[model samples]
Target chain A: MIKQISKPPLAIDDSAVDATLVKRVQGGDVRALGDLYARYSVMVQKAVVRTMPRISDADREDLVHDVFLSLLKLVNKFDRARVFRPWLYGVAIKKTQNFRRKRSVRALLLRQRATNSEDNPVHPPADGQLENAEIMEKGLSSLPAGQKDVLILHAVEGFKGEEIAEILEIEINTVWSRLHRARKTMLQLLENEREEPGGHENGV
Target chain B: MVCKYLYKYLDGRLDWEDRRLFEDHLAHCPACLQQTSDWQQILTVAASLDNKDVGARVAPPSSLDVQRFETMARKRIEHLGRLSFLGRPLAVAIAAAVLLGIAIGVWKNEAPDTPHVAAPAAVSSRVAPHKSDTSGAPSQSLSEAPLVSPSATDVHFDTKVKELTGSETLHASAHNGQCAHMGPDTLCLFPKSRAEVMVSDKAHVVALQSGSAVFYVQPNETREFRVTTPLGTVVVVGTRFSVTVTPEHMLQVVVKKGTVRVEGDNEAAMVQKGAVARIVSEKSGIVTRLATWDELAAFSVLSKMIEEVPAKPLHLKSAKKPVVHDAHQLQDTAQAQSLKMLDTWRKEMIAGDVDGAIEGLLRYLQAHPNDVDARFLLATCHKRKGHPKEALALYQQLAQHQTLSVANRAAYLAGDVCIKQLSNPQCALQYFTPFLDHSGRDAPQRGEALYYKAEALLQLGQKKEATQILESVVHTFGRTGIGQRARNRLREIQP
Candidate 1:
């Protein structure tokens, strides 16, 4: 029997094109692989930027590389039966999370050494010279990864709750709850920012 | 309670029933509307931030980085190509043992009869098998008959070769065949029941017109070579393998060392060492099995002596040119340059520089118009660059070369482009029909091909025929993705 239908079936735009490209890549068609990379590298970059807001250019590039490398090696294992974008999103998320974990371990080591590193452990505090974009990035960074993922995918990336849930491998109801809580937390943070000394009005 | 519908409505994910209920509630609700308005502002901010991150902040990997990665990947792929034989080490060891055993057996019995004389370049004449006539050879005739005339297309061999003619009147009469010596390698012909073979002077390729032969390719041969038969093609870099066509029209390949890829009909399979691949008549399918007597003669002393000598390590010529060359270094240089050009084209294509690759390929094709491989590459570039009309034109040209290795896949891709990109399903049918007709029943994309044809038929207002095709797909490929797609289409039509 068909499982419960998600609110929006994850339909990637130009999915047939993606399928053809995938088949060609499987056949070792280098041009098709290059086209696949050209088409989706931007999406992968966006995912890293949002999911990992404060990452360095090098780290971000590394994460992007890892995502594509994983795609290249493991593409044969991908179920062509399913949509490609959701699977790709899953890879991006997992790679970013792995990077985050590695960074945390290094941060812990630095802390033990009492190293005065400029970069924060995870999410750095908003400094005095924060612009609107930086402040917004800081706000998204403050939320838990799950909530950040839901909010960005839903409100930012324009994916539906069901599609987000599929990418995150969660329930639609869970996606809604995460979204609601994320918004609540965002409002509270903005309110707190407004009341801070020398702080400007909340950007949002 | 209204919050659920509110979230869905804001996200634009609310179903009809939930949307109607939410609207009815919104008509009477003030507090919810104010809350939604506040939420809308936050959402807009979030959307803007995402847009800014993508448009201004997030940066894709630099082209330099991509080129580095592509370079590394290309090296890795090339390494993998060279190491393909390593995947079946045990098979190789076992095949080597069995082959050695057969060789030793033949040598023990036949050693005393033949003289230990090195072969001459032109041994076309057959002498009676007697030790008194010319030293100690008993089974094979010594060279005495006049040399057979060389073909017009024959290359300038370092040494002359004797062509053979079997007696048409003698049934199963023994016609002793001499091994053709080319550099360090040897080509032995063991034709059974009216087999004809052609040996190339360069020793890089052989054509079997109507029989079986054993090729003991020297390991020093760096470039991959091919043995073409009427029924199949066996490609290998360096290996000991035999290609034979059975009376039943099955093309059989037995790999005794390294690995060989057999391409015939609509399929191709890699026959590793000790493995036998039988291409059924008409290239319907390939059947792989363990090596048996059919692969090589049970007793052949000459075959045994070949394995007794260790293979020389291949010394590749240069980094720029990897092909191993003989004394005819000029020919090798030209071939190597062509290969290097193809590699450059591949790298360009993979870097998303289709325009550059297309220009290069077009120019290259002008000089080599009969190079179907270049045209195929060009067709793929067009397909990837969203030029369906150009891709179709090239594919149509390629489809005509039925003997080309990638013709089936090229035809299928052409049809796929037609149905998916061009919206010319009627045109797709022309290619799809031929592809389906040629493809075996168990071909992987048969179901998808059928579904595509069915969709085209439906688009042409042939619903009844389309439905029937869908039913066939659902019944035949019931659990596959194509089957599921067909089922979904059937549901839409039936409902």
Candidate 2:
């Protein structure tokens, strides 16, 4: 597990230190690279965790490493005239999204094979008691990626619809609509489950 | 319309005017309120499902990881260095020509005034001088080679301490723009410039702060000589090479004799004779190309060798380890006067003062509201005091920062509190799923994370996935404590 320390967010006004460090790193200073790592490793890790919430620790570490490597490689491409945070955030989000996309494909293929295999059943007896979480997972798994992302980001991550809209590159109304649909779908699934022969509401 | 309002109202996505209208409508409608209540119940349960698959967030890679990366980066940089040379196909062919002696043969046949057609002439010129035997076969041609002048003086340096490994070796001084005769067979020549360098005799290493230095290592010697720059390290067994740290702190290694290894970050490269390797940054762009003769001209002048000054024997012993004390007790008073840091809370908790620890953390949080670690500690103390709801809320808040080192643990704890302490297994499912998802195969808590996820699945009547995860835990982690519990649970569920 990565050891994380809490520090205040980097002041938006403090681009000077970042500039000097960037210059040093561009100049091929390995120690300066280490300094940059110390400064932003946490921020990058947080971005990975928040964006790809289900990613493992080791994978997260590798992602963080890749982020720094990308930063170093593309440091020249970065517009030093602008703020570093937004650019870094964009890179982090893109990398995480790519990771999720690739993983999703792999998982989908695995799930498809399982469904195709007659020997491998889809699930055990439906008579097994349904926990609220299990029912929700099933509901969530059934939702589309866009809806699932919005639901998790808004409901679980506590991001505002507007904030999520910008983060996910969708409209604010889209975020709202997705959140609403996600919730509606979850409720519908739960309601349907309750109507079943042996099903109970599993009230909170 | 009722579903729309209830869903939007629960999500807090309703417009202000709509919200007011909904409130007015709900005030008179008991049925609407009940519907809202049921939806809220589902929403609350759905919320827990988000964190169910997450594992505790760890801190960034440790210092050890950083060091390992550095070593790996060094090797990669060296490899990239050679790869850069390969990028220029012309340079590669020219290097091949030099090795086959075709370049030297062509050069020997050409008139002295003939314009050098290739960069190999200048590169080959440097190595030719050092290979001369006692009769000076190669040095005989030094006059004909425009780059080499036999008038330069031999530099000298005092031999410093030597160490085998796992220790530091000290050098006497650096010769700014001057060459030094390192030993009987080793000759180190520095370009006319300003730099600080430390040469270690036993380890055969040179630490350069700035400027460039060329080394002529006799081929017969079996020992390796290494040059350490601010950017990377260059290691050579026996070679004629020059290392320069440019103004941009870029490390460039030019090989004139045998191959030299250049390492930066996680990468390494080997620079063949007449080839130059440069690391522009820690990034992937490593340049290795054939060096033009003009670029090799800087190393031609050998400085006046300064007389050797014997270094006084300075014995260095390892420093004794410091005594350990309670970090909170000693650090809190020293670092902060008013604030009770996490150490203090830890000390209180370890002393079995759960109330005191909770109070201290609360007081600390009062001043440092952004302190998630303190919040996490407070939640742990709350759990110890058997206040599951309070702890769950705090854990949720801490878990919001997915990157937090304790976030995964907080998520797991939240699930545990909800399922075991609060009897909300549905909520536990949310936290447990995320915990299982993010938990690495090597994580000590993986068994528990898997078990909890299974338990949540079983509770939700999802027996297949639950059974699979439970069986996995039992089989994979059979020797562990949680694995035993998983086996027992599996039997209970299947029977």
Candidate 3:
């Protein structure tokens, strides 16, 4: 007979662990909240950082803080029997959306101000600096705001298109349409870049 | 039932019967298989990019922090309570004063029987001649309150128009201090007003606040009407046009029509009626010239067709293929057989036999280990069976293969298993990184891989590094799904 290695104590069954933590938290055991946070923060932080690329480290930390604060406010509303990870993730996703909307508004205002200043024409980034990544970012940012939101939720956040629709309060078909258009636009832009002499490093 | 099942299947939230049916569909439908491949790729990319640190780092706000917040909240609440006690009488007094002012204003309007109130009522009544013509039954509720006083009602209507129509559309009509939603499709059809109309599949009606009203029509179907705008889009069944109001607010007409005319903005250019012209800057005036085919394609309606059936195999029966080489024939034969096998599996899955589908795929894979499609399907089947370890192993094997395309698919699957099932972002990064190196044109998988790689990095507590990768994804494939995700992620990370 083969001997099996003993499972570690911390290797509690996921379902059981979540149920216990939820029960404790609901019972006003503050430490349970900390435990849950410790368990899920790494994933949430990773998700937030990956979603908000242009945001600085300091800003990322602040957003992470905001997510936690929001989560606390929502702990009481959680369904104890259900897994907390998805619910927590949903909160993180919402916070990220709010941050992006605010950033977009700020960027628009800044652009308007700069345009009015007349000090210098807003020149496009120099050719050399337009890396594949930068080109991709510009193309994405140029998309309609709604399209950008749906595409990001479905593609980056790892949410199903249906999940995205639910979160964004739109139809799933809309998400699909936005994603399709976004891809087509990106392809067109990339192809255009490739056509220019010495424009893109990876020529077609 | 079909939509529900598809949703559940895609979400991996399906039970046994549904899962079996989904697998059968996968086995039989080549088109569905291709779509499945695409969806798998997307999921893989997303998993690779997901923050690994999410579960590990998420801690509820500390007791001390919560206490501090609660204390502050308590103090604020107490302060508000006290303020309310003193504010009641003062608020009542202020309310009485406002009511008196309103009463005076109403008395003034009553004395003159002001033509202002009558003007709106009469104009609305005229615009909607057939009150009983509920032909297009207004889906949205229209407030019945009179718009006589400069009261909240008028303000509310103005705000509603601004919200429903865009700022650009309302600018002209709002300036004339008049804004209204006309017929069902016509939100604000102000005649003789200079309006900027944005016409596309997405429609909007803008009412300009300027003396000259601008009308923007994003017309869906063919409808002819004269619209006055400093800049407007005159759309035909198969054409697009633009009219703009310059900084000087002068109307500039740019015709992007399949067949239309440029009458006002400047010199009348009797375009073939299907050409594009631009009202140049305020200094230059209207430049109504013919547009190129590329420009025409831009305004061409973008319609997507969703097929219920899978994509059929391309029949290779061309005149040039009369005598094919043995090797080429063998390859074609193999492709045909693979397609048939896929179809069989889909039928089985649809019949609600997930295991049978998997068994068939497994047997097929044994003979064709190099078959990326088969391998991917098999891995997915295993995943559906709740066997993440086996699925992960197969995905890993495929990810390490020589072909970049095949490897990318495998890498994506591996990443999906790691992040979604195994909950291991560290493991997912290992799979995602190789795909990112060569994620280029034929491999949209690369954009996806880079996205996942960023997620894995973040999970590992490499915040700065992850942010850099995400930024790169946004910059390189910004318009693509992966790029959008990166941009969204960047926003979430902001302070």
DockQ of every candidate structure: 0.08, 0.09, 0.04
lDDT of 2 at A18: 54
lDDT of 1 at B318: 44
Predicted complex 2: DockQ: 0.09
Could you tell me the lDDT of residue B300 within candidate 1?
28
Candidates ranked by DockQ: 2, 1, 3
Candidate with best lDDT: 1
lDDT scores in order: 0.54, 0.52, 0.45
Models ranked on TM-score: 1, 2, 3
Docking quality band of candidate 1, CAPRI definitions: incorrect
lDDT of 1 by residue, B1-495 (tens): 565566567667766446656754553343344345446546655665556545365654443444565555555546657344223211111111111111100100111233222211122222222212122342122122101111111212122233333311111112433345334344444312112233333224444332224444433312223555444556552344555444343466666544555666555555555577876554367677766422332222234333333343444344432222232332333344455466466556654578977988887787679876578678768876879899999888777775632455567767877888798988889988997887667655677778889988988999999999999999999875457667777887886
- Residue B58 error, candidate 2, Å: 7.5
List model 3 lDDT by residue over B266-294, tens digit each: 22333333244454432343354443322
Count of steric clashes across candidates, in order: 5, 55, 98
lDDT by residue (B1-495, candidate 2, tens digit) is 444476667677775446656754553343355356446545444454433333135464444555566555445545556334223212111010111000000011111222211222112211111111211332234224321222333434435422223222222233423434344223333332222333333334444432234443322212334555544566543344565544242556666544555666655565666678877665644578876433343333321121122222323232422112223322332223222246456546644578977866675567568866578668767876779999999978866775634566677778878877887778898887776676555654566667777777787789999899989998998965457667767777776
Q: How accurate locally is residue B391 in candidate 1, as Cα lDDT from 0 to 100?
A: 91
Which pairs clash in model 1?
B103-B304, B114-B137, B115-B136, B115-B137, B125-B145
The number of the candidate with the highest TM-score is 1
Give one digit per residue, the lDDT tens place, for model 1 in A52-85: 6667667777777667755556778988877777
